[model samples]
Target chain A: MTDPKTQTGSRQDEFEFFEESNALWWITLAPTTWAVHFVLAYGGTAVWCAKFGETQGVTVARLSIAGLTVLALGFIGWLGWRSVRRWKPRQNDMEDLSHPEGRHEFLGHAAFLLCIISAIGVVYVAMPALFITTCR
Target chain B: MIRSLAGSGRRLVAMALMMALAGCAGRQSALSPAGEDASWLHDLWIVMLVGAVILWTALNGLFFFVTRVRPNDWPERHANRLIIGGGVIFPTVLVGTLLAYGLSMMPHMRADGDGLVVKVRAEEWWWRVEYWPAGATAPIVTANEIRLPTGQRTELLLDANKYIHSFWVPALGGKMDMFPGRETRMTLRPETPGVYRGQCAEFCGPSHALMAFEAVILTPGDFAAWLEAEAAPAAPPATPEAQRGQTLFRDEGCGACHAVRGTEFDGLVGPDLTHLASRQSLGAGIMEVTREDLTDWIAHTRDIKPEVAMPAYDWLEAAELADLAAYLEGLK
Candidate 1:
């Protein structure tokens, strides 16, 4: 039989680990980065074309979009790498229900998967700039 | 029950086919493309339509097969394979291919930067046309009817004086928005000599439905001749009644909002009446340009088109109305 005080202390420790590591909150950064990149690329190109379409403005717009794509991909790759390192297989955990290391592992696995999907989404959105030479 | 469901599906498909066939013929139908730009758009539409039909049939066939024909005790690995292949891989390939194809065609849809330029300004319920010939000092101001030479690219500079409007000539090309204070451009090269109908695709105000125009694509010689005639002033009224009608037009304040070239009436508020009688339609393509229609339009302008800026002149005597219509009809 386990002491109730010991059980409460272990649960508190699990919650503390979850909060301090910020795994759950950081998972959303993948999609958030994709969304921000999409909006900036589309709006920047449209407004730039409307203002200065005939001159060197289109070159500037293309370069700016390329810079943003690289930055977003780099951030997502870093997050994915960090999550991959933290992720642990469920079999490695102790065969005890009260010890909840599985929860931390699950969070890491989800973050890693989400980051991959977000990176693919960003690339897909950037593909439009490759072929559309003009704003028309 | 299965037989009945199949019968209903057959009936639905038949009905859809009938409706599609019915929409194939019309003046404003994009399906009847008459120019290079429209031909490209039509080809794209056909490809997409064929792809959609195949996709829909395949998806429905898979659904039916899985539910009714497949064995219930299939292996778990098979089910997992189906989920990954049909759910993820198929959609990704399909959408990616479509996006690539659409992106490749974007640049080809725009103007090639070699053509004559025509400026079109969208008013509340009409169009103000200005011809900018090559190396001309000032643009030739015209209205409503746009005459383009067949087999030559013509670039249109579209702008708006008030609200947003869209310039759409279905047989020629795709629609481009006419934005106020900004100039947008579209190009069209008509392949045949015919009159195509155009309309303000954007809803501006109460009379939006009645705001229409015509694109007259003609032979090179005819187009040149027409342009020369349009550049000149209105021909003087020939008959006695027409001359009297011209006097009435000047005395009744019609000159305040309308302009007839080579005359003292140069109001810029309405369409130019330099060669009004030569046009095929009147009231912005709503009525034929006949003497009776003109008389009716003048007497009951508000009745024919509600909320138009032009007011009714019902108080004029019948003979005077006839004389005015004759004069306008002879301006060409």
Candidate 2:
């Protein structure tokens, strides 16, 4: 007999990202955004400070970090929204081990929380631009 | 034997404690802050340490409570809340606040000067210091010691001769780098009037550790008087030995690389010895500026401070060396 999941042709199969049930790779997604933001903040600050010095460099660095922080937060927020929905907010809905959604819900939940952490980290990276203006 | 071993162990612990306590109060200690910049840094360090202890204890306490007190697996919502609140939200908020607080102090720590300027050029293992009085046309040049007027912000312009060096007077202020051909400025407003110590924080060469200076913080009036005296020429040698030593100093080509004002000994390489006796220490704060120390230093330049630019005058007779030392001591 054919599997009921195949027979029903559920919408979940169409949206399935991975071939298997392992969604562990999703955990790295949030922290990676933080890492990228960190690199951009430091490298861009160095370049701007070197090129423009104390006068124009401060404004340029501040704007760049502000822009980066916004873009990074937006991306993480979107990911968190999708991940949290899959994670299932209701406590009673969390124990359905047989369902594929609940099977991967723990990973999604972790990724969502991590997205919040990464957004905070992005803000951390951008903090120096708020006060530091001199190359010396 | 057992009693002896115990006694030795106790002595060792006492010695370690004494060393640690001594480290906390010294002329070159960051803990003993004598300026606004260093005090802010010390405060930041203390608060960060306290925050670290609090976080560590709380996190460990949570673990202890969970595993020992309530071993059962927590409810789904409670577990999620615990992880999110403790791991993510709490740490982020605490650390972010601390980072902002530390960054905010930079602007104040690096505040602009209040008219006084000091140019310090870092050579291989010595400091070339110049004091520019307000409204003065030229700087009063000296070496190996920095004298500042207390209660006023002084702008220090730092540069290097051969390689990169760092100027740090920990009790007075923070450290800044000195780059060759590039001038980096830092400001310090000394609050305590005392003789502090400074050192080259960077490793440039063999005598890097020996490269140190005295940071003398004086009252404004005293500083002005000292500067006035410093700007004058070297006095005539009084004693007969000093007079003979001056002749030796000139004839022996010591003037080729060292400059002494009011004399034909004008050289551009080594430190200015115009007022050498008035300095706090000889050989870049390495030893006391005494006749004995000066004689030993001359006889053993490389041995005392390894790789110093000064050549050993070991060929001179004992009498001749004494005469030279007397002449140098008469500079004040």
Candidate 3:
């Protein structure tokens, strides 16, 4: 088998034109954004209620949540768009996925799908802000 | 004589289920709602249960058809669509819709309360409930029992003195937690007039399960009269035994923790015993408020509620115990 990452001294397919740097980081970036937003939303609300008491700073909390949600979804959307445009499917029956081209497509498709799911999660986490007006 | 084994097993299972379900209509069951919030929760539960049953039947029907009736694999032309639609799109849409529906009801579940305010402090293994009437300067204090009026929204401001405890009355509404420095609010608008049991939903200490209280939802007129009476002084002892028992009560130094109004025993560490005789139960709803239970509780305080700060009076003779019990029972 050829080297999976570099593909040195190996025959390359015509579709193998990928040149994204630090490619594996994109797979984890979307989920990490979701986690950060979740923690900040929960911890911020709890601290705000404990210190200021009954709905004292609810307006500010809601605004911060809305802004954070938009920022997170925008970053994930960019990653998803980039991955979808660069994605390439397997061509024939005899193609071995151990080749560099097949591996690249698999990673790209996986990151793209993860971005979609993470975006949904962020949306669900933020939906409560629309209904729950109080600090509770 | 028993019939076939399978038939006997089915009959036994049916009888067991019926016996289990018979316990659902009581003071603690959420299914038997006495308030508006609990009624809505019961309705939401029914809808969810029916939706789950329908989904289960449909999924199982598809499984049986695919596995048993159609053993041959379908053409590859339709394979990708079937895989994507069944595994991904169907679940995403279903869960998303359900989540949206659930979130939409969040604000209404904890709606604002505009009626009378009743502040409750959750102490170790007991409740210190105070009612703030419309034009009162100080709160009317009580313990181990809560009373609310019907046809109006009653707001409950919950807090804790030491450990984290939860105040839950299933027949009235949902549970609310109480922290030492923080306060949580919940509103209950009880429409039915009856007695219900409230318990500490969070496990706080050694006798957490034994920490419970009785809640009475009364008509507006009856509640007004009851509140007026609760604010007054304790009635004087009527019989000779009760009078001597009251003297023994003060001599034994029981007044250090428990308070009895209209007397010199003005303590604040434990429950108020001014109206002890009128209450439904004693020792935080562990036993009936009868002469026998009162005597046992006063003698065996530590045994009745473990880790409680109340001291035991086991050194007192049987006649002294009986007189003290009689005194407490006559404080109505």
Q: Which model scores highest in lDDT?
A: 2
Instruction: Calculate candidate 2's fnat.
Output: 0.78
How well is each residue in B58-121 modelled by candidate 3, as lDDT tens digits?
A: 6677677668988688775465566567656666666666666667766777777755889999
For model 2, residues B1-332, the per-residue Cα lDDT tens digits are 99999999999999999999898998889999987777888898898998889889988998898899998998878998998788767877788888888899898877788888999999979999888877779988899999998889999999999989999999988899999999999999998888999999999899999999999999999988999999999988999999999999988888998889999988979899999999999899898889999899888999988888888999999999999999999988
Q: For each candidate, report its DockQ versus the true two-chain complex.
A: 0.62, 0.66, 0.60
Give the residue spans of candidate 1 off by over 4 A: A1-8, A15-21, A47-52, A74-113, B1-19, B71-76
Q: For model 3, what is the error of residue A35's alpha carbon versus the real structure, in angstroms, after optimal superposition?
A: 2.0
Q: Please report the candidate that would top DockQ against the real structure.
A: 2
The Cα local distance difference test for each model comes to 0.84, 0.87, 0.83
TM-score of each: 0.87, 0.87, 0.88
Off by over 4 Å in 3: A1-21, A44-57, A89-101, B1-6, B52-77
For residues A1-136, what per-residue lDDT tens digits would candidate 2 score against the true structure?
Answer: 8888886675566446452244577677779989999999999888888888656647777788889989999999988997787677665255663465566677677788788878888888888888887665
Candidate 2, backbone clash total: 0
Which model, 1 or 2, shows the larger lDDT? 2
- Which digits, one per residue and each the tens of the lDDT, describe model 1 over residues B204-245? 888788889988889889988988888899989999999999
Give the true-structure RMSD of model 2.
4.1
